[model samples]
Target: MPMTSTPTPAMAKQTPKQPPTPTAKATKATPTRKRPKLCPPDVTDRRRRPAGRIAPEALAAERGSALEGLDWLGRPPEATASLLYRLLRLVARFIIFVVFRFRIRTSGQENIPAGGYFLVAAAHRGWMDPFLVMQALPSQPRCWFLGSAPSTFTSRWRERLIHRLGGLLPVWRGGVGIDQHVASARAVIANGAVFAQMPEGTVSGPAGLIGPFRTGWAVIALRVDAPIVPLAIAGTEELYLGRRMVSRVLPVTSARALAGLDHGAEMPPPGTREELDVARRMSDALAAIIGPVVESIHPRTVDPVEHPRRFRRRLTWLFLRPGRLDRDG
Candidate 1:
């Protein structure tokens, strides 16, 4: 039996295989592309090519069209609303602030730049809130207000008046119109124009009560990198008593600067829900900052919460309205 066994091949002769290690070439990653700048159309227009084959008049028209681009506000012709527009603006201001004696208590008035696309926010109390909002500018930076459509404006004349007022961004409520609204806001902001909004939208329901503010302001501020200015209006309700309310230029942005908002943490990435949340927080923060200052100007009513400084009829012989007037005055 021992002689019959044949020798088997040696196990030592077989090679053990090793797993492959990755080489630098085999594991290379793809490079990333940079994002394009999100500048306004006006800025973009500076680089467009001129038309080569049009007649002089036609070329002029074509050239204007090409150069009138704005990242936001659509191409507007060089025309503005009629002179009647200016007169009406003058009359409106005269009636509300001057003849009526609606006093404006402005603080920190030096902060606002004379012009630029910035975001301005303030408390909402009445339909006249817009008037108050405008009258109180540090320097009159024409604002683009996001509002209902021209049809919603109802009155044709009023619609024309609004457009003439400058920067009235129209958005259709509850439908396709919001396109115009967002577009208008985006255009003005991209172009370095001012856009003021009552983040709370609409005249507030009543005094001492405010509705849930919409996130539109946050959206625009975040997307456009525009400065946000929080404002507080106290004597407005009182103005309705004897005259229309007049606005005042408060140093809100400056106040924020004085309050040190400028040096705070970098704002969250703009154009995200996070940006909106920041806007909400900002609204709350500004409200907190101004609440005390406002309280001192107009005390709240215990029986029913008050709205700013409301003046009422004095029972005195000379101050009564209508039939209550003394027959022998």
Candidate 2:
């Protein structure tokens, strides 16, 4: 076996001085994007509009088609009162007074303006409330009603009958074609005929429990410079034979008075904050005036014993829309 030679320090080849292994340059981290914050349904954001309310532009587009075949707006109220209207009104009177035997007691007939046009703002409790009001008034100058087109024109016959009646100014709720409705109402009031409307907007709530009154009627009254007669109706909520209904007409509320203006003062321009303020004030005033009368006549709490089960469901079914009675209030 050969003995191995011990290698000297110099004999070991110098390790190659290679370039330091390149350290990976610290990679700049890419930032993750943040998601947008979502708001809850109940949260009212100033930047966003409330749901279910139509934007003004979309409402404008709908107005044209809404009033398209409603030629009655062009004619005066008297022109549309044909023979059919008179006969139908007579039949309605017979049904209300003779068939149903509803004893209508009225007061404040003196409060109604003698000659010029005015508005009758009432609480709508039943389907026959309008006819009851018509019966309460003098039959010479028929009152034109601002009726919901959807509710009033449910069938083709109803639409034709309403059109022939000549006293209905059909309005699309939820701000559809409101301009045309206001215009038609103004024309009706200007023609020396009374215009009537339910400020509650619909037949909701129990008798004497008036809903929040809408300001649309106030707006129309202001525009036409007419007085709003607050008419309180009770006992029409449940109709039956020998039902006694009372209609009381409160004092007249003039547009000037409602706007907080003195006689001979000009009204605020339409769509102005001042005009809206006036409308709200008028609505509140009318509600206050009519609420007490309603409550006095027909209290909110009913004694089940007094209102018997006899003909209750059947009578309610006869006058009210099926499954749509808004008694929840």
Clashes of each: 14, 0
Q: Can you write out model 1's per-residue Cα lDDT over 40-63, one digit (the tens) per residue? A: 988867875532332223432533
State how far residue 124 of model 2 sits from its true place (Å): 1.2
- In model 1, where do residues sit more than 4 Å from their true spots? 1-85, 97-101, 138-140, 149-152, 174-182, 206-211, 237-276, 300-329
TM-score of each: 0.53, 0.72
Model 2 pairs whose backbones collide: none
Judged by whole-model lDDT over C-alpha atoms, candidate 1 comes out at 0.47
Q: Which runs in model 2 stand beyond 4 Å of their true positions?
A: 1-74, 79-82, 299-310, 317-320, 324-329
- The candidate maximizing TM-score is 2
Q: Residue 216's C-alpha lDDT in candidate 2?
A: 75
- Candidate 2 is scored at a TM of 0.72
